[model samples]
Target: MKQLRVKVTNAVGLHARPAAVFVGEAGRFASQIRVRNATRNTPWVDAKSILSVLTLGVEPQHEIEIMADGPDDTRAAEALQQLIASDFAGKI
Candidate 1:
């Protein structure tokens, strides 16, 4: 398994459109990915599910932890880290 912790810097944090973008990016990987709101000390949730991610209640400046386990775990973790690091960039 691979894991990373990153702070959310987007204006709206992970909600609505940003949540959708996050879920979409997570779906692109073959690895099983999970995320949790580190700042909130929330339980891990399915990164591919919008509902699950939304339950995290992530907000701007919140720190989140992501984990991936599978053949592409490393890439999956890194890609997600980049996505959040870039504030979802062009994808949002």
Candidate 2:
């Protein structure tokens, strides 16, 4: 498994649109991905699933841990981290 820590920088955090964006990116890889708050006991979602991502309840400034498994884990981890860091900058 590979992991990355990303902070939600958007005012609305990972709301519907941003979460959907994240879910879309995650689907490009074959890796299994998940996101969870550092303070949480369980993961928020299956990163590839938009519905699961929206359920994360992430808020501004919240840090989330991203994890992935499979051949594309590294690339997926990088993509996920970049998404949060850039605040969906260019993509959105």
Candidate 3:
């Protein structure tokens, strides 16, 4: 498994559109991606599922842990790291 620690930079956190974007990005990879609000003490959720991601209740300034397992895990982890670090390409 590959993992990354990223801060949520989106103004609204991982709600709605941002969550949708995240789920979309996660779907591109063959690996299984999961995310948890590290700053909050929440259970990890499947990054590829919008409902699961939204349940994370991630907010701006929240630190998150992302884990990717299976083939392409490294690439998947990096992609999500970059996405969050980029503020979801200003989509936030």
Candidate 4:
């Protein structure tokens, strides 16, 4: 398993479009990915599910942790960390 923690800097946080972008990115990987709102101390949720991620209640400046376990776990974790760190960048 691989894991990373990153702070969300996007204005709207992970909601609506951003959440969709996040779930889309997560769906690209073959590994099983999960995410949790570290700042909120929330339970981990399926990263590939829009509703699961939206329910995280992530907000601007909130920290989130991502984990993945599989053949591509490392890449999966890093990619997600970068997605949030870069505020979704070209993805959104």
On TM-score, the leading prediction is 1
Report the lDDT of model 2 for residue 3.
Answer: 90
- Of 1 and 3, which scores higher on TM-score? 1
What tens digits encode model 2's per-residue C-alpha lDDT throughout 9-54? 8878887888888889999999999888764545657998877777
Report the lDDT tens digits of candidate 4 across residue range 1-92.
99899999999899999999999989999999999999999999999999999999999999999999999999999988998899898677
Q: Which stretches of candidate 2 lie over 4 Å from their true place?
A: 39-44
TM-scores, one per candidate: 0.97, 0.90, 0.95, 0.97
Which 10 consecutive residues of model 4 have the lowest summed lDDT? Answer: 83-92
Q: Among all windows of ten consecutive residues in candidate 2, which has the lowest summed lDDT?
A: 36-45
Evaluate model 4: give its lDDT. Answer: 0.94
> What count of clashes does model 2 give?
0
Model 3 per-residue lDDT at 36: 95
Best candidate, lDDT-wise? 1
Stretches of candidate 1 above 4 Å error?
A: none
Write down the lDDT of every candidate, Cα atoms only.
Answer: 0.95, 0.85, 0.92, 0.94
Ranking by lDDT: 1, 4, 3, 2
lDDT of 3 by residue, 54-75 (tens): 9889999999999999999999
Cα lDDT tens digits, model 1, 1-92, are 99999999999899999999999989999999999999999999999999999999999999999999999999999999999999898777
